[model samples]
Target: MLPPDFTLLQVVPELETGGAEQTTIDVARAVIDAGGKALVATRGGRMTARLEADGGRLAQMPVQSKNPLVMLGNAARLVDLIRNEGVSLVHARSRAPAFSALWAAQTTKTPFVATYHGVYKAGSGLKRWYNAVMTRGDLVIANSDYTRDHVLAEHHLDPDKVVAIPRGIDLDRFNPSWITPDRLSELRDSWGIAPDDPRTRFLLAGRLTRLKGHMTIIEAAARLKAQARNDFQILFVGDDQGRTGYGEELAKAVSDAGLADRISIVGHCDDMPAAYLLADIAILPTTVPESFGRAAVEPQAMGRPVIASNHGGTTETVAEGVTGWLVPPENAEAWAKAMERAIDIGAAKRTEMGLTGMNRTRQLYRVDAMCAATLAAYERVLDARRLTGKRP
Candidate 1:
């Protein structure tokens, strides 16, 4: 017999190389792997390749256009597509696309799902209403308990409607044992580091947004660089995402600190596992609470210690002394002090922490575990709909 014919549509603003975008691709692949029809609809971006490569169909839609008329047109287009393709459920990943998906789901009586991936702050009523779409999903997915609580506090959404499905990481891809020595050497060389260098490599991976706390990290690095007792390299691996000026400002800060030789911005790393393997430590210094810190978990899976700002999902992912350190958010001094602790811990202690982290991540945050939970949630949603004899 053929596999069950349930169609799932994932709507997003764009498919770029970020935590959320990567999850979209992974979830799409998971749906197909589970013998379902996986369809991704978006404005189109870098992530489309993985979606199509996973044997999922891509439906290009400018659901991200902010204009009222454009959103209405997108809604109509979505409605037609949903009807034509017999989409069983429509999932939206962002506000712009959520509006269109909401309209289409309402019109076609399909299940509407939304995943809240960030701690979105509302500036005004209009912005709050715009973000309300996320809470309106038939079955809302919160990337963390922190994110779930935010939804309840901000939108007054029902507790039952909001389900916590923490973001998943691919264990197989991130396994330290799987990372080849040649790959590590290649990445080290590409980053302009000598293979024989005794200096530890520290990485800060994220888009160069103000919220990422690049300046804060740079300040911390300067302190480390100035210390005569320490030797280390800092690699900032991510594109600026239209924040060229911010990137330049950060570069200037590094230059002014006289740490230019040890600090480099390596843009858009394609081989993240290799990059993580080369790192002695990973840092995430976000000013805002990350709904889930993928950077924290990925490197842990690679048996590299991670240090993150103490807030949001990192509270659960990074176990202070067990996995890595968690410093006060946006404090350069605190970050620098943590860096010193990391450096002082010695190789044997760091190795133990990395091993503990690897086991912890495998048990709790594996991609397969995430995918299974998601599908189980979908089943529950469908079952509830059947019982209620209601159509969204």
Candidate 2:
């Protein structure tokens, strides 16, 4: 729980999408539930209503703007907001907003925190400096152990200051038992899955990007087809995020491989819990390491075994042969073998793996646990500030 006077403000680009945005909303609810004030400064998005409904105050601002002058103006405005609202701590989720928030926090002498939400590419010194703002916090939160190691290697911050807090999933929402038959039927109908279809369903959920390894799945499907292993359906369920070229390219790959019937690029899905239920196994073949693979944990929460890339956060989330399988990243042959192994295991074995994953997920990655840990981090920073009369 937080002190009554603790007014935590989280600055993010927007609440439109992605894990960071969802975490902002989840932490905001946690703050309110703990009897503390929660404030979010952003450009506002579809999720703003959800934030406000949970008693989190919204200070609409142009924090998402990366223009130099706009960021300076945002810093001044944030300084005013902090002074006028008696903000206790500033937590920033992204770089552009962190620059502005860092200035305001320094101006107000408030404790500042930042989360390294992604493994950003820093090819240039300028980009490295820009990314360094995330490390400039009094305490930096890395979303996974992999991310934590990356942060330390790249930034060389004090070992004690950077905390590895894995991303948490909403177990209740993702739970299989909570998914009614009607929900399953609806999604099956919408996605054109027949009630008596005997094909094993595989889900590869992520944005349509080269980094997500969609083409790997397509290639694997083609390999499966070559062996006449045609008893599986692979669904690519995710938004393109306006990357139409990649989407078209994926479609062409499927067609060129003659696996069009086996592969379907179903766009963004709002009902993921049900989607996971519809599939026997979930796949996260991200070409790069996910800072924290939420996609892996979520399907596990739904009691569906996963086959993720053998790198990144999946190394921590997926329990290899226990909960799921982790093949070499972007290796189409490895992915094909993994998918074949999953198929050969049969539904009973897959269910057993899924059950193991579900139990592990419940123990390690629930929203409440994440919220509590985050709030405790906030408390530690605050207590340090009060005791030392300086930022932690």
lDDT top scorer: 2
Q: What TM-scores do the predictions have?
A: 0.96, 0.96
Tens digits of lDDT, candidate 1, 95-191: 8889989999989988888999898999999999989988775788988888999999999976888889988998888877787888888887888
Once fitted onto the true fold, the runs of candidate 1 whose alpha carbons sit more than 4 angstroms away are: 1-3
Per-prediction backbone clash count? 0, 0
Q: Where does candidate 2 stray beyond 4 Å?
A: none
* Per-residue accuracy of model 2 over 87-184 as CA lDDT, tens digit each: 99999999999999999999999999999999988999999999999988789999999999999999888899999988999887898888899999
lDDT, residue 182, model 1: 86
TM-score, prediction 2: 0.96
Cα deviation in Å at residue 388, candidate 1?
A: 1.6
